[model samples]
Target: MEPAANVLDLNQLRRSCSSCALYELCLPAGIGVDDLDRLDATVKDKRALDRGDMLYREGDPFEALYVVRSGALKTFVQNEAGDVQILGFHLPGEILGFDALATNLHVSQAEALERSSICELPYAKLQQVTSEVPALHRQLMRVISREVVEEHRHLVMMGRQQAQEQLASFLRSLADRYQRLHRDGSALNLPMSRYDIANYLGLVVETVSRLFSRMEEMGVLQVNRKSVRILRPELLAALCRSDAAPRRKDAG
Candidate 1:
């Protein structure tokens, strides 16, 4: 067993992590260099997973809070019928296992969508660190708040949007997230397959394929297999706006 106090090196991790787009968000709102060093000292372990690897299964005992160091993860719950309902896609800088904080059992399984890395902060040590460091508490609060907002957005998407609108919204949101990760927002290299995307958007795989074809035909985007280039982002945005009026109504 690894020693409880085996912490990652602060300066080395920071230096390696400086180029990542998530660095600013991963640290607290007002964290300085010295504070970051302290926070880094608390990270107990780092692990990497390949695409299609499972990080944790549902019902596993939750022991640590995980922060995505790079790549993406899909978190989902399995129903009694064994159908999977994707909860969310976690990008780098995002934290996982919070839902289990109160109950101690993981509510969903976290699966890697691509080659990914994560930093594990042991829950006991994390609690101690938060007690000692005000910034860490603030950072955790911010993470929780963001999750709430994202959940609300997902609810709205599922409740209100049509299938096409939902698909467009998902793609646009993905582009924005990709941009935040310092990747090309306009050009997307989809890590998830059409089936995965279909499941996530609550649509059939055929519907997802059709929507992609339609978007391409409308000159809104160019698609080839898993790669997409947004040709007309404004038009794509319009397609995503289910509440917006038709062109004639807007003209009037």
Candidate 2:
């Protein structure tokens, strides 16, 4: 017998929680209709940009926290000597642009890694909605807090982890984030290039390439250019824990 036909309308979802498919990931669940309506009125969605476009550069006056509606973006910055550092990658349902929350000026730049569109939550209006909805206010705080934790996690990895451990952590992170976005946890697309991954993980590009190859040999991962399949997710995740790194000759 043939498999049952998949039947689901993709167009029925609205920008707000009642009908939005990303309700669980994009917005805090259980917000009342009034709050949802307020959010729908304030959100500016579907703003598009091409690859290589800078969505917002450093020093630009900050206005809103942008959410990926489709496609992908990269947040990075240049040092005084003009070398670029990749900060993070944002996928659909991810919120970014909090750099200016306190000082009112952007410190890093956000650029499109592919043809992308984002929904802007104007900060001024977001502040108002948060005031009305206590849950939403707490939700915003949680988002900002996660970004802070991610920074600290990277610092720890860079300071103590070996190259394989760092790369393993990186792959596991990507797979986990994609899982949160409702994509397959076992196999997914890596929107950013190896260079970006290397910068974020504090490894050289060649070392990153070699790590992927070795992981495949160990049955931990399978890589085909930009796509990575986690063949041994448990082992890969274990590599993320302190001191659990697999012993290998080139682990240095």
Candidate 3:
């Protein structure tokens, strides 16, 4: 196994990440050089989490907003049946814990699916900074808006799309997000396991595996365990846009 990383390494990474893909999307427009320095100073970087580690639990006191600097995170809520229904997967350059911003209490749990580094900006300091920095405020609002829009889209994906479409859309969405982080979007290193993907996609683990195999056979993707390569982006996009024919139960 690889040795675990340290907090110092995380801090160094953050400091050196001046050209990160999220810099433009995360920071407010027209932020002055001095303001950027202040914003950087307020962030507290944390070491990457091992697989299956809980970043925070539901009902935990909300203290800071977390930004995923690298790797993936899964947020989910438990149903009455004690099964976890995953809300979504957060990629690098995305912010987590927005639901807690207004209520000051977490409504769901965030867990690292792999070795994930994060930077925490304390709520108190963030509020103060936003008051002084108009750009920061604007950026925060944009982030919240993006979350709302994504949630709305997810609702449609779950309610209107068939199982195959849902699965295709999920893969395409993941690829897009990965690309945003300057990673190879077409080649996905899935941090979440088959069971987690199943829970998130509202399907069984076997069904998830079957879908992967079928997509591979159809030349839509190349799958090997947790890794996936999109062999035909256009076909996958077509399926995501509700154009692909539904696969038979046995076919997928």
Candidate 4:
């Protein structure tokens, strides 16, 4: 048998990138073991956070990218009037810190929505490694492009006037993201509060609450506080595409 020290090292290797639950989603497709090893070396320790913790504040210098290993975070910016506008809700395996790439300073603040763990990849070291691995460079571009696309999609989502449609689309989007993680699409646990959802959707908190109650009454979903179970996904899909105005009760 191998020495105890050697056996410990072997166990560490087994838990590296190749063995990560999100390896396929977070890393470049078809990347080899050697490349994976090199990339894994740049990752710092997993940082733990509790609810309401600030991962990074706006204007902080960006030194690394963060991947949500578990739980969730939300990024937001505040206006001069102190009104907060949530930029995005980030889930597991998704990368953050791209907002700083252009200016070298974070434009938004990132906060943990619940207990979470994040993998930090120092950008300078990451760049050096990616330069030696062409596939890694391409993957970086793909992640950046994805961030741009999501920003555009969010802008469009906020432009719609119907509260019901907006709420439905938001739920559907979360369900789709959950499905991507190989979880149940019909079940969702919202870490962000209803007020946060309202802010993100460009509606008032009262309207958001009313919309959820209406959807539950309509048999579209069952809401038990933060947990929601989608019952009529088809109806939600229709709400997203429909041009009809919301009922009088939802006019809050």
User: Stretches of candidate 2 above 4 Å error?
Assistant: 1-18
lDDT of 4 by residue, 212-249 (tens): 99889889899999999999888888888646535565
Positional deviation of residue 10's Cα in model 1 after best superposition, in angstroms = 12
Candidate number with greatest lDDT: 4
Q: What is the TM-score of each candidate against the true structure?
A: 0.86, 0.90, 0.88, 0.92
lDDT of 1: 0.80
Scored against the true structure, residue 138 in model 3 reaches a CA lDDT of: 84
TM-score of 2: 0.90
Which lDDT tens digits does candidate 1 get at residues 1-78? 633446765545444433345777676666666666566667765789999999898899989988898888999999
Screening candidate 4 with a backbone cut-off below 3 angstroms (N, C-alpha, C), the clashing residue pairs are: none
**Tens-digit lDDT track of model 3 for 1-252:** 523654345544456334455786578667787787778777876557887899898889999998888788999998678878899899877899887876789989999988888878888898888888887888898888989988987888777546778789889888888777777999998888899887877778887788888788889998888889999999998877655656575633
Q: lDDT value for candidate 2?
A: 0.83
What is the C-alpha local distance difference test score of each model? 0.80, 0.83, 0.81, 0.88
Displacement of the residue 227 alpha carbon in candidate 2, Å:
0.9
Q: In candidate 1, which residue pairs clash?
A: none
Report the number of the highest-TM-score candidate. Answer: 4
lDDT of 3 at 183: 76
